[model samples]
Target: MQQGSVDAFGAPVSADTLKRYSGGAITVNSTQAITGTVSNDSASQVVTGNNAITGDAFSSASGLPSVIQNSGNNVLIQNGVIVNVEMKP
Candidate 1:
């Protein structure tokens, strides 16, 4: 897999599983793009990346929250879940 190449999941991932693997922090390398579906249900999720996201990005429910940081250009985030997005320069 490339630095920022998006990959698909075989099935839906549970919150606990995702948290265990990522330790609540998911980082994307420079100039990377996430073009796959991201479903996070952890208590607190943080996604730090710098590049374009041309796919669906989702967070947790009201009880659980998420913080996503990425660039401001060519990023398309559309989901019903509520999350705090910080757009960097």
Candidate 2:
């Protein structure tokens, strides 16, 4: 809904998922399955997922995690730095 909002998902994202990073960055270092659109656009996203998954909206040359386990995906990555993102499935 806004920037720098922290959320906790016990399941998958089945809606219009949009996240904004305003402070520093959002570190996604989980071992769960994120099935939705993931974006940040104002800061950086440190994706270090061993078993984390996405749903859709991901791009390869968009400075995103090319090795995402799932499909869901963004933000306007600056200088290869991810900021806000919008992910959905």
Candidate 3:
């Protein structure tokens, strides 16, 4: 993800946050399930489930577009931007 890109999860992340979590700048490497509410800030949020991290979140940072799978829906983030959100039927 690039700086200034807002993921489906709402607010424009701070530059520091972007630098910390951006595709190429990520430092940590691991896969972990995230449940409940995930938010970059008050304006941006995403509800996730046990399958939240199907892959390494940090490793996939440079993957451009990534999907955060959830029990309710799926969020698509491309180039650090929130491009599309798929709602469960």
* Per-residue lDDT of model 2, residues 1-89, tens digit only: 43444466345433345223233345655353435544554434656435554565463346444442432234322233335453434
lDDT of 3: 0.50
Score residue 85 of candidate 3 by CA lDDT. 36
| Number of residue pairs clashing in candidate 1, backbone atoms closer than 3 angstroms, sequence gap of 3 or more or interchain | 0
Q: Which one is best on TM-score? A: 1
Give per-model TM-scores.
0.18, 0.13, 0.17
User: In model 2, which regions exceed 4 Å deviation?
Assistant: 1-21, 33-89
lDDT by candidate, in order shown: 0.49, 0.42, 0.50
lDDT of 1 by residue, 40-86 (tens): 43433555457543445443236655556555434447534534554
Between candidates 2 and 3, the one scoring higher on lDDT is: 3
Model 3 residue 38 lDDT score: 46
TM-score quality measure for candidate 2: 0.13
Q: How many residue pairs in model 2 have overlapping backbones? A: 27
Better of 1 and 2 by lDDT: 1
How large is the C-alpha RMSD of every model relative to the true structure? Answer: 22.1, 21.2, 20.0
